[model samples]
Target: MTLSNTIRWLGMLAVIGGICRLLMTPLELMWGTDNTTALIIGGITGSVFIIIGTAGIYLFQAEKAGVLGFIGFLMTTLGNILVCTMVMIALFVNTALQDPQILEQDLPGPIVPIRIIMMITMNLGYILFGIATIRAKMLPRWGGALMILLVLMTFIPYTDYLFAVVWGLFYIVLGWAVWSRSKNSETKVSVTQ
Candidate 1:
C-alpha cells in the first residue's frame, strides 16, 4: 500500500483509540480511577492504538515538524509504552492487594521511580510535540496546544470521570487532526499520480 493509505489507516486507528478512551469516561465515573476491569482493558488497548496514531501524526508532518517534533515523538512514544506496563501491573497488583494478606497501597519501590519518570517524560514530550505542531502549521494549533494544556490542566482539582472526559476529548481532537492530514496527503498523492 502507498504511504498515504497507511497514514489514513493510522488516522482511523487513532479515532478508534480515542473512542475507546471516550467510552471509558462512564466506566471511570462508576469506578473512580481504581484498577477496575474497564480501566485495565481500556488503558492497554487504547494505549496501543494511540501509539500507532502517535507515529502517524509525526510522519504526517515530519519534514515540517523538524528536530523538536522528532524529539517529542520519541519521548511521547516511550512514555506511552511505559503506560501500558504500568497499567498492566496496576491491575494485577490491585487484585493481589485486595486479599486479607496484603497491605500496600502502591506499587513496589523500583516501580515508583519508573512511574515518576513516565509522567515527566510524557508531559514534556507532549509539550514539545505541541510546540512543534504549532510551529509546523501542518495541523491545527489547538491540537498541539491541547497536547500541552491537558497536562497543565491536571493541576486543577478535577475528578476521575471529569479528567477522563477531558482526556478523551483531547485524543478525539488529535484523531481529527490526523484524519485531516491523511486526507490532504492522499489528495496530493493522487493529484501527482
Candidate 2:
C-alpha cells in the first residue's frame, strides 16, 4: 500500500521478469523452437514488471523529485507497457495464429510495420528511463548510466541485440540493489525506532 512497498514489489517483479527474459533468449538461440511461444512466455513474464512499474509511476508522482526524473519514469513505464503489449500481440496473433513461416522467412504482412514501430518506441522509452534512473536517487547512478550505454549500443544496427543482453544483466543488478537498499533502509528505520 505504501510507496516503498510498491517500489519493493516492482523491483521484485522486475527481477523475475528480467530473469525470465534472460533465460528465454538463450532458449530461442539454442533450441530454435517456436518463436511465438518464446515471445508469449517472455511477455507473460514481463507483465508482472509492467504491473509493478505502473504502480511505481503513480507513486513517483507523489514523491519529491525533479521534473526530468518524473518524466523519465513516466516515459519508461509507458514505453515498457507499449513494448510488452506489442510483443504479446506479435506472439499470440502473428506467431500463434498466422503462419510461422511468414515471420521466419520474412514473408511478412502486418508484423513488419508494427514491429518496427514498437522497436523504435520501446528503445526510446528504455533510453529515457535509463536517463531518469540517473537522476533519481532511488537507485544507483551506474544503473542509469549503463542503461544509456545499452540504448546507444542497441541502436548501432547490428549490436542492439547485444545491448538487450547487457540490459538484462543490468536489470538483475538493479533488482539486487533495490532489494538491498530496501533491507538497509528498513534496518536503519528499526534502529532509529
Q: Total backbone clashes of model 2?
A: 1
- TM-score of each candidate? 0.85, 0.73
**Model 2 lDDT, full chain set:** 0.58
Q: Which tens-of-lDDT digit does each residue in 79-192 have in candidate 1?
A: 888977877776666677654223244656788888888998888898999899889887777878878776787676755566555555666776777787677556232212
lDDT of 2 by residue, 37-129 (tens): 566555556555644643443243224335555565566666666667666655665655665544455645675675666566556666766
After aligning candidate 1 to the native by TM-score, how far in Å is the CA of 89 from where it should be?
0.6
Q: For every candidate structure, what is the RMSD over all alpha carbons to the true structure, in angstroms? A: 4.0, 5.3
Q: In every candidate, how many clashes are there?
A: 0, 1
**lDDT score at residue 89, model 1, on the 0-100 scale:** 73
TM-score of 1: 0.85
Q: Against the unseen true structure, what C-alpha lDDT does each candidate score?
A: 0.74, 0.58
